[model samples]
Target: MYRRSFALVAALAAVLVLVPAALAARVHVRVEGKTQTIFGSTEPTLNVKANALDALDAASLAGEFYYHVAPTAFGPYVDQIGRYPALPGSPNGWVFKVNGIVPPVGADQVTVKDGDTVLWYWATFTGAAGPLTLEVETSIVRGKRCFFATGRNDAGRASRVRGVVFTLNSRRVGSRSGVLCTRLGRYAVRVAKAGAIRSRTYSGR
Candidate 1:
């Protein structure tokens, strides 16, 4: 009876250990460097432990890129991603935001929910607010995916951004809304402009 009880207790402990991992959040992660979209502009889906740092780690794994975290007085700070690190007294440092807003704390201290989008980018802060972020809105019409683009500043004000270039399967497509699944299936769509961070990679079925 004693042995059986010990085995049961061990099994319960095992189950408990696995629960948190199973409760891991499913998120979309995007990393943008100074010149181009570093990662997740092609594949953005990942399941990770709940935090912005975990989301970044998952992106590093999926994209096979590199990142570095440094300890700070507040908490662990991600000072580098890919080939870029935070420059001293320079605006070209790294910053992260969940769903278009930078949290009031460190990346390791922020909790990320399921379906959240985590963006890590090289920031070139010219003012209090950061750079312009881009996003795409898509709709289905007659089995075609119609894509519309927009840009928002750190102030949360958003507007339609025209002259958006659509890249379907890594090829520049002419029209935005005329692509259908018959032309491409189970693929990614990324839009870009001149001086804005690229939009999240929209996947089509």
Candidate 2:
């Protein structure tokens, strides 16, 4: 009976060790529409076991990017991301969202779970016109995928754009034809159009 009890205890201990490893958070991190690092000459999707800041650190970009956090009554407030600083009197700065909804706390304080997605974007507000926006549309034409990217200035007017580019899975795809993704694997579409300073990534099904 004692041997059986010992065996059961060992089994329980094994489960206790395995459970947390199985439940460790797996998150996807993207910066400016590209994978964070190139591992062995191939861009691998970043999956972290901790929060967003931990994921950024795993990518070796924790100190490479510029940012500031202020000690606030609530918590640390992220003031800047990259070169975009939150203006003192403007509603422009770095805006971040997890799975499409803006969090009420800073990125460091937001705990992520498995299969979570973190997106960080820069919002530019200049001179009261409005914030510049870019939109990308994908379609299937002649059984081929195509992408149309448009950009609008602060005034909300479509302008003749340049530097509009597209990439799929971290590989640049031709502008005339959208990425011909023909597999069952995950794919990411990144678009940078007009004079926009940053690019955005759209996950594809």
Candidate 3:
């Protein structure tokens, strides 16, 4: 009896140790073209274990935003997030992708794993949304950390925009013509063009 009790307690302790690891999948989420009002994390990443819908719910609860999910034959469909609703007679709505690929499953069914990125953007299904992709490349030039940004359309074609500004922590640091200098702390870098392009934010170290 004493041996069985000791083994039971040891097994319970082992399960407790493993439960947190299983529940702590890191996932990055981005809601493009909207003001950053989600959980006050760095770039809206889910450091805890969560599915796609779970991440959205956590953000909505933390940010006090509204989101609706409708039951469909396939699964739960996202009807509206915040003030944006699916447009009638159009494919415009909240479309999402995991790891840069559009998944066939609904957000509720999509299980997010560690190091996976989930992007939710509000735009028409048509390719004219402008700057569907944005990336910041960092390198060391002349012993200084430099950042270069690029924007691309849905067709994977690059975009040419004038006066591309790089903002660090909401402050404009430099333009596209020049390399941006970095600071010690983590900075949220946003690059944008006027009118024809949508802005994208990336984390800079």
Candidate 4:
């Protein structure tokens, strides 16, 4: 009887251990217009266990935040903004370094938790090509998928080309034809044509 009781106790202990292990916490992340629901925690310290960093890193790369991550450790956090090596000789340019409550520009030191929003705004600039702007709005919505949209326009010398632009979010799973797909997480709007500004939504439900 003692042996049987011991066996039962051991079984119960095993179950107790397995139950919690199986019920791991999940962190859902959405990108562009597509929903990526994942199960895990995003604590930096606990990264060894589930490694939410990898998931976030993948999302960041696939989404609009790709530009925010610096080429080096201590470099242009928000390169898309006005003054960067990318935009040589650009005048009358500005970046939302500190807009609203969020710091538009951040270093690699910044830790993007599970529930965080990253917005990238491209304002007008003064140059020969004019203000070639590519704005992307990104955020993790309901921990389901990363949502984003991109709009491009030109101003100043290129003011005549101030109008609609469109790009595809191929990161979305099983996407076909840049249009008509849930894969439409974000857009890559560029001045499709010059002349007039025509606003349009290039995605679906």
Error of 4 at 44 (Å): 21
Q: Give the alpha carbon lDDT tens digit for every residue of 79-140 in model 3.
A: 78877778567766776666655666788778888888766666555554433555566776
Q: Write model 4 residue lDDT over 53-138, tens digit each, in one string.
A: 33344445444344333464555333432222235454532232111122323433334443333222333444443323223233
- lDDT per residue for candidate 1 within 56-160, as digits (tens), equals 898888889999999878888778888888866877788888888877788888898888888888878778878778776677666765676777777557877
User: How high is each candidate's TM-score?
Assistant: 0.75, 0.50, 0.65, 0.26
Model 3 residue runs over 4 Å out of place are 1-24, 33-41, 47-50, 128-131, 152-163, 173-187, 193-205
Q: Model 3: what TM-score? A: 0.65
Name the regions of candidate 1 deviating beyond 4 angstroms: 1-13, 140-145, 173-188
* lDDT of candidates 1 onward, in order: 0.78, 0.55, 0.64, 0.32
| Residue lDDT tens for model 2, 24-84 | 6766654442223121111224556566655544444533565566677876666665555
For every candidate structure, what is the RMSD over all alpha carbons to the true structure, in angstroms? 4.1, 7.6, 4.9, 13.5
Give the Å error, residue 168, model 2. Answer: 9.1
Off by over 4 Å in 4: 1-57, 60-85, 91-105, 125-205
Query: Which one wins on lDDT?
Result: 1
lDDT order of candidates, top first: 1, 3, 2, 4
Residue 33 alpha-carbon offset, candidate 4, angstroms: 14
**Which consecutive 10 residues in model 4 have the weakest lDDT in total?**
33-42
Candidate 1 least-lDDT 10 residues: 175-184
- When sorted by TM-score, best at the front, the candidate numbers are 1, 3, 2, 4
